[model samples]
Target: MLPEVNATRYVTPLREGGSLPGIVEADNHGTYVVKFRGAGQGPKALVAEVISGELARRLDLPVPELAVTHLDPIVARAEPDEEVQELIRASAGANLGMDYLPGALGYDPVAHPVEADLASRTLAFDAFVENVDRSWRNPNLLIWHGDLWLIDHGATLYFHHNWPRAGNVAQRAYKWDDHVLRPYATNLATAGPALAAELTPGLLEEVIALVPDEWLAEFDFPSAEQARAAYLGHLRTRAAAWPAWLPGAAA
Candidate 1:
């Protein structure tokens, strides 16, 4: 389970994305970028962040540490903006907090070229999860201490948005021409099997278990366990069909 921390202060809103995440200080004396439960995307987005981020960590990918942040309604009083205040008030409960990376620079492929192997692995991971947000137009990656770190995985596992048809789309191929790392992913043939082999049923379950029950409750699954089972099943199916979905695998 992720460590729980209460919000001690709300700093400012991060205007980079539409969700309106904010910088916050927690009782643990740690600063974080908190993705609110009240955002238009709701708690499901938070669930994807936890599952995908943790899975990346397990795959030896860099990702910020995540925690369950508790927000109190009183924090809304400090905000003068009625719109922001309303968002804060609506998110007066469990939210997702990503450890803030101070001084991290946005990744620019031209300035910081990625290695072929690393790029292939990254593309493979995104393909497996059906993440559609890592395009050049909005690359959700950061560079800290000269190392790449994946962020903002809220757009992943999109199939969950329509559970009834998740199976039909689970095997859909990833469109990678616009991927920020596509040019550097020349070793997908090697990276695909290497990464897919690591995503065992047990490993998938371990990663899914990291998501909070409250977020899982919003889904139609009868229980959190059932929801986890569904996620694992979809991922397993995707992994088995990797040759069809992984970009550059045939090359």
Candidate 2:
């Protein structure tokens, strides 16, 4: 389970994303980018951040620390913006909090070149996860302290949005041409196999268990355990079908 903390202060809103995640100070003395349960995307987005973000971290990828933040909503009283106050008041329970990375710059493929090795691995990872948000227009990556960090995984795991049709898209192909790091993913063929090998069923189950039951309760499955099984099944299927969906695998 992710460490839980009480939100001490609502700093400001990050208007870049549709969900309106905010910079919040927590009782743990941590500054986090808190994805609220009241956001338009709702708690499911927070679940994605946990499952996908934590999965990325276990894959030897750089992702900020993630936690379960308990919001009181009363903290919204200080906010002058009605929209923000409404959002805060709506999310009076558990939210997802990602450790804030200060001084990080948004990734620009042309300006900050990534090595072929890392690019291939990143592309392969994204492909296996079926992430459709890492396009050049909105890379969803950051460069901090001369290192690449992945963020904003709320867009991954789209299958959960419609449970009944998940099987139909589990093995869906990923297009890499528009991928922000496509040019540098020269070793994707090998990267695909190597990374997929890391996703053992045990590892997948472990990662899925990290999601709080409160978030998992939203799924239509008979129980949260079944929901976890669904995610595990989808990912295991996708991981093994890398030959079909992993971009550049044929090359």
lDDT of 1 at 51: 88
- Candidate lDDT values, in order: 0.90, 0.89
TM per candidate comes to 0.96, 0.97
Clashes of each: 0, 0
Clashing pairs in 1: none
Per-residue lDDT value at 69 in model 1 = 97
Please give the distance, in angstroms, between residue 88's alpha carbon in candidate 1 and its true position after superposition.
Answer: 1.1
Tens-digit per-residue lDDT, 76-110, candidate 1: 78888788899999998899999999999999988
Residues 122-232 of candidate 2: C-alpha lDDT, one tens digit per residue: 888888777889999999999999999999999888888998899988888887779999999888778778998897888888889999887888757778888888989
Off by over 4 Å in 1: none
Looking at model 2, report the run of 10 residues with the lowest lDDT sum.
242-251
